[model samples]
Target: MDTQATSAPAADVTSLPPVEVDDAEAALVEHYPRLVRIAYLTLSARLGRHRRVLLAHRVAQRSLPRGRRVPEVVEAGTDPAYAVVRLATLRGALARADRVDGWRRWARSAGNAVPVPPRVIGLRLFPRAGGSEELALDRALARLDAPARAAFALRGVEGLDEESTARLLASAGVAAPRRAVRDAAMSGVNASLLVSGEFDPCVLQARPTDLVRRRQHVRAGVGAALAVVVAAALLGVPGSDGGTEASGPPGSAQAALAQALDPASLLRADATAWQRADRLDFASWPARGDRTGDQALLGRALSAWGRPGASVHVSATAGTPSTPPAAPPRLLFAGDVDGAAIVLLYDGVRLVRYAEPLDGGSGTALDFARVDGALGASASAVVLARSDGNASYLTAPWISGVSLRDLLSPSAAPQAIHRAADGVTDPVPSAQAATDANCGTAGATWPAIRLTPRAGVPGLAPFVLTDLGDLAPAHLTYATGRGAVPAEATSADATAAWAHSACRLASVRGEGVRTVNTWAFADQPLPDGAGTAQWLCTRADDWSGDDHVLVQFLPPGSAPDTPAAVSASARSTAACGPLQPGVLSGVLWKARDGRWYLLGAGSPEVASLTATGGPRSTSPTRTLVVPARQTTQAELTGRLTTGGTLDALK
Candidate 1:
């Protein structure tokens, strides 16, 4: 080692001449790999190995000056050009690793900005793996701060003495050069290990990133770009507002709106299409709203549907897609309802409704719901207007008559409700109209729209639909006895069964419920010779393919319309639906004689029942009765005849 030149004073170091750009370039080309290795070691290890390798190369290549002469001063004991480029590379690496403060740091933290090294798409570069000794040395060096790493790399990789390392660290903008040298000494790594190929950036391993994911990202990016361009073009088109035309030449907006707003362009069904149609969905519905002929109103609706403004409030039920329609949709209704101009459109898969203030003010609202496979009862009605705790519906053409029935009053006769010439019914109190105090009360009335289908329509039945704060109301059905299939709540037994289960509908309000079915699963004689009790399971299926299962126990002598005691409830399960019709549940009951018993029951398929934990009991039958204290707890399971074990619903 040239100790004399290495130990030269700081004053002599500051007096060295600047190197020419050509000389600096030549030096960098000759010693590029060594410089990159130094930079790679000096960077913060938080950057992964691949990024560190590429960043090291980037910083080393950027070390050369743009001017004819490099202004950086040279250090003693090193080639003047090499020393200049080396110092630049060290400063660049340290700057990258330094902590950023203020707005730039905040921006990076918020993901609004990122200061990363240049990246090459679909390619990753990393240094080659090395032996255990080299790995241990690399890890130890990584534990030091950036400035200390630079000091250590200078001493170990470049064979520089401590004095020269300290001087170079200070020139690289390190505040505590002597302390950094001391910190580097704490790593205790053998200097020979630092020269291994493991730390060499030039000796790299190149691999391709996820090619399949890359293709997907590229396709998605292209699609998003195209959507943005189309939206921009639509917004820029002039004279597309109603019938007003711009002063300049006609643009694409006029042509687009002309095609979209033309009443002849909309797909409309014949007045009696439902009578002979193959499917009883929205496709068979005829245009019936009074304002269907108003071209201006139709144009506004079509424009908003295609490209809604920022002022428009858009909402969709779960699993409903909110994308713009690909072609002109069928017109179902367009009229003024309540205080808003409403438009209903269907695109075979989704129902889209648009509403704006009738007085031409703001507050436009758009709603969407999935009604893809609707038939018979499910397609009986669509909500026309909802405001002030009341809602109205547009009954289907096949619906011969509409009546209102209070679900809680099973014996009360159905009251006639009037409908306009266009098939829109008068506003009635919605389920949400019930106050919190009376929502689940026995005396509270739950009004449901009862639609009587036209005669001679096979498989068509009267549907009891109730509003749940969604664009489409949920259909309510009932099952009379064990193993009975669910159907419309039209029969005497079915109507009485729904009277007990109607109050439980409050649990699924505003959940985008599509259908609610009440099944009388079991009727077991109570313990202590008490009168028989009924077990019912009510399942609410939502539009998102998720179902909520609730088991209720109606004890003997309960009121006709009294709410049943909830035994067990579960969401997103197949316990009560057709997929797994068998259900097992248990509840602790207190008899009139002041005795406590653990009462358990299962569907007929459950061959045996077992109760364990706090109160132990087993029964070969589907029902289990065991004595227990009031505060006792237990786990129940049932074994089906098919050899499948079912856990108690919770």
Candidate 2:
């Protein structure tokens, strides 16, 4: 058995008080290097390299003495006893340095300084996977919520399991759930390997005496003058030029890095034609460790992924799961009509990734399936789902085209980008089709109802589209008919017409439209006389919200009625007339489940039906209710049997 993997005699020594300061100090002296590395890793991203070194030392100085107050036998051979203490100290030190925003702000700012990678002197948990993996790991770590990132870093980098990880976090004043800790650990390990850096077997063999001398020598070498330079730059100290290095525009190196990683620049090249010639020019990007291979892969992915006549347009802003990526979140755009198979990807700074279209065309009518997108726990394959009667799974290496023909289903589902195909069946008929069949424009297409994708996890939910704009005039006309529409009516006029049609005797005082869940339209609170000449109710429904209309037409002189007021107890109330003793007709709406119902309706004889309170019943009440699904034409037809008007009740 490797003695290095073994722990001290006690597994739970956190609560144990230090029995001997001398013994613990001796052990800490030997483990100082490892402790310093931990502190450096934790603070470097938030504080600049110089400040990180300072804060890291502060953490070590604070942690070493804790061995005396809480003596524990954590030596080089066993798990370090000060692991928990080091993490706690680092968190506190960062707070004191006021570098809480750290490198995070630099990453988001447009033309800031280039990030200095964290330094690693010893210990290789994993071999270098190259700068790409480093970039990937850094992005993954950045996206994690603070608690999750801390829990994951400690558990994975320090080899603490969930239980121990939770305890460590709690000791640092952070409340973490066991499940979240476990999740962070599982998500963090691979990335943490790149982060922890290459382990140094040589450091393991060094004695405490040699490390102490080396530490002192290095401090003496840095000297006061070098510290002064860094402090001056950080403190905005004026120079001979009357400005500091930071006050000047970004240095040439930083400007180049920013340009190389900028997504907008890469996308501009790919706009007119799929094969971006400008991007093909290797001189456009910063020189990479493997420039030849990176350029080749990027070229192939972009060239083969696009279709002729596809117009590239930015679709949505892609964000990672937990933290911001090294580059700003990539901009995801869709190619024109023919390019439905291709989704362009650009890291805010570069076109690092792109999607190649599947071999055969998706027979379904829709080109892209609009679904919620999500990030994976690990670096997962980019999956493609088709309405080709099957879902295809493919993975693109750092720089290559993943053929749709060679698609293979992985044992586990990878993060996918689902695209709906042509000829596929739509759950709800098109707005044109849903309109009254007798209406003149029954076959006309409603651009407002075009299927548009939303940002969410790829495969968890079905891809659905929402209306890009508000309901068209034809749709409103279909719902209320020509009888309700006045000559040259405005949108408000149409609404009033529908209200008057619904309740013939009642004047149209006000009208409103709501989504399925009761989210009001922009014109929800229009004045009594507000009116528009054209169909201007342009409220694009959120795809997740589902575009289902709920019309609430208030009778000229009445208030909206609650469901309870129109049911059971108030059946005998004088205000409720012969209509049904207690039915509400003020709010009439269509439901997705193919049903139409009247809500807050009162007796026709009474202008306003007011309900009196009564006893509650144990049994369910019988009342007309709308199903919360996409409304269909058949249901609308059934409910509007009397020509889209409920005037018969009045």
Candidate 3:
């Protein structure tokens, strides 16, 4: 048996000499399992048990120094070697937990470049199960944040006192070590519970993962490999087209390929097509980019659309197919913008944007979005370039005016924004701006592009579009009253209603959103003649036909931009949409007289409302009011006029 892997003796450093690389290695080797356990407990529990196990071992293995170098001396009364390694382990786990945002997440999504521990096929590994006390400890640790978990693990498992744990946490770059210690103490778990064998990752339970399903998957993989081998062999034959052609006859493939690459075959609309066209969409867009006449660039882009190279980064919105177009695609734009050569193409169903570095570098990017039935407001703009948290748009040809509007400040006049001759607007702050700031605060502003179509364009309304980190910006629409149909949100009432709900858009950013409709479903009167309140529902629909709905309550006398309290929210449901057409939600409100009340409201279809739990009350109408406390936790339900029961939106 390997003693280093199986056992770790307690370190005695009362009279140890100055530490070196070899000393660190010795300490790491003897205490490797303990260090792994510490990292496992410190890492975020959201990563799941298998990944946490592997990541903990990987972090522990990398904690040792690479070469013979002088190690930094830690404070007295502790082994410098163990202290250095422990700090490194804690820092690595914390960094991993915090890397789920910003560019790191983008890089991982685009290229899968985020480093991860090796994964085992058809096997799962987890720490051996302990008794109820150990399970309670695990649950308690999971409830705390990463920093607090680190504090607890160090103080408990490592047998360190509060001062040592704080010092170690500080050395590991924790900003508030004392606060983290306090949070850990408040977890209501005894520190001794953390030292149990249940938390020991080195003693793990291994199990095979779905053996029957794995066998089926293996057979399918083998069949796929065989098919690839046969296709390669056929392509190697002389006088063959090298598998470049579509699945058709010999000459038809050549004809299709020629048409796809030929610029003259592209459907270019006349500059004044919108004035005479019956349908107002991309079909009326005239090719306007500077490089539209560059045949070589267009050819390259066309070829890339059919078959992108291995280095090309290709992404598509949900429900958007990445396959090649069946016919010659229309060229919308092809120009050099912000150091990148961009080409935009539209087949009747999809909008494809292909971009490559202007310097001829390897960072080529291709994006696809579904615009099959886009018309009017939905087809008003497409994102031309997004860099440094700002986005520029290529507006439709009929758009004669462009301006920036802050949805959170409806009273503010629309600010004029610069638009180029080619119709590309100047860079405006993207949705990322709202997410980067403290949401719902006064500083958070959501900038929306307001487009004004030329006069005499029937059925076209001036509308606003906001970038949601996609090739196409999501259209914003609104409705004023209950059971009203949503329309272009350009009226003052719509703008004012959106002001209280705009900050909620941050939740749906970067989610392939296509359109967001805000509807004021109900207005309720407050108790004791305080004032009236408004209940609004904002539904964000994604490209995949799923919707995210949020119901908010706007109290009387709130600031114009004050974010409304979220009463309820749900995903992938039609609770607040035309399908369901009914929504019920409640909020605990404090009146001006220092009395708390439970306020509930439902859509027009709701005949009665009821409040349970902390406050029990019922109303024969669509609104409910009851006296309550600040800490009151209540459940709201409604009975529809059609005799069906409804629960509050979750």
Q: Write the per-residue lDDT of candidate 3 for residues 306-373, one digit (tens) a residue.
A: 66667789998865667655557888998988788889999776789989899988988889887655
| Model 1 misplacement above 4 A | 1-264, 435-443, 481-484
**What is the model-wide C-alpha lDDT for candidate 2?**
0.30
Candidate 3 backbone collisions, by pair? none
Could you tell me the lDDT of residue 56 within candidate 3? 89
TM-score of each: 0.62, 0.25, 0.62
Greater lDDT among 1 and 2 belongs to: 1
lDDT, candidate 1, 1-650, per-residue tens: 11222444333544666678999999899888788888988987667677688788889998987765533434455677887888899998997764466788776668835554566777777777764456556667767888888987788777777887887888889999999999888767786666778888888787776454355445434533433333433443333344233432256533544454455688888899887898788889999888888778877777676667778899888756565554458999999888888999987667889899978788999898877666778787989788887898998898889999888788999988899888999998788765334634656888888999889877887879998777889999887544536888878877787878887888788787889999888888987679999899999988656679999998998777777788999876667776567899989999999999899999877899888666777899998889988998777878887886676786
Candidate 2 C-alpha lDDT tens digits along 1-650: 11122222335556555545565455456665555555544443434334445456556656645433552323233434454355445465434433534466555444535533333443212222223334345445545555666565555455655665566566666655575576676663473453334321112221122243244334423432232323222212221234445653355433432333333434322222212222222111121111213433333333222211133222221111111122222323332223234332433222222333334443322121111211121111222232232323222111121111000111112232333331121222222222222222222221111111223323322211112111101111211211111121123333233322222101111111111111111121212233311111111122121222223343232211110111111111111111112222333334334454333332222232221111111111111233222232111101222221111111
List the candidates ranked by lDDT, beginning with the highest. Answer: 1, 3, 2
What local lDDT does model 2 show for residue 411?
Answer: 19
Query: How many residue pairs clash per model?
Result: 0, 45, 0
Residue 105 in candidate 2 has what lDDT?
Answer: 51
Candidate 2 accuracy as TM-score: 0.25
lDDT of each: 0.77, 0.30, 0.77
The full ranking of all candidates by TM-score, starting with the best, is: 1, 3, 2
What's the residue-level lDDT of 520 in candidate 2? 14
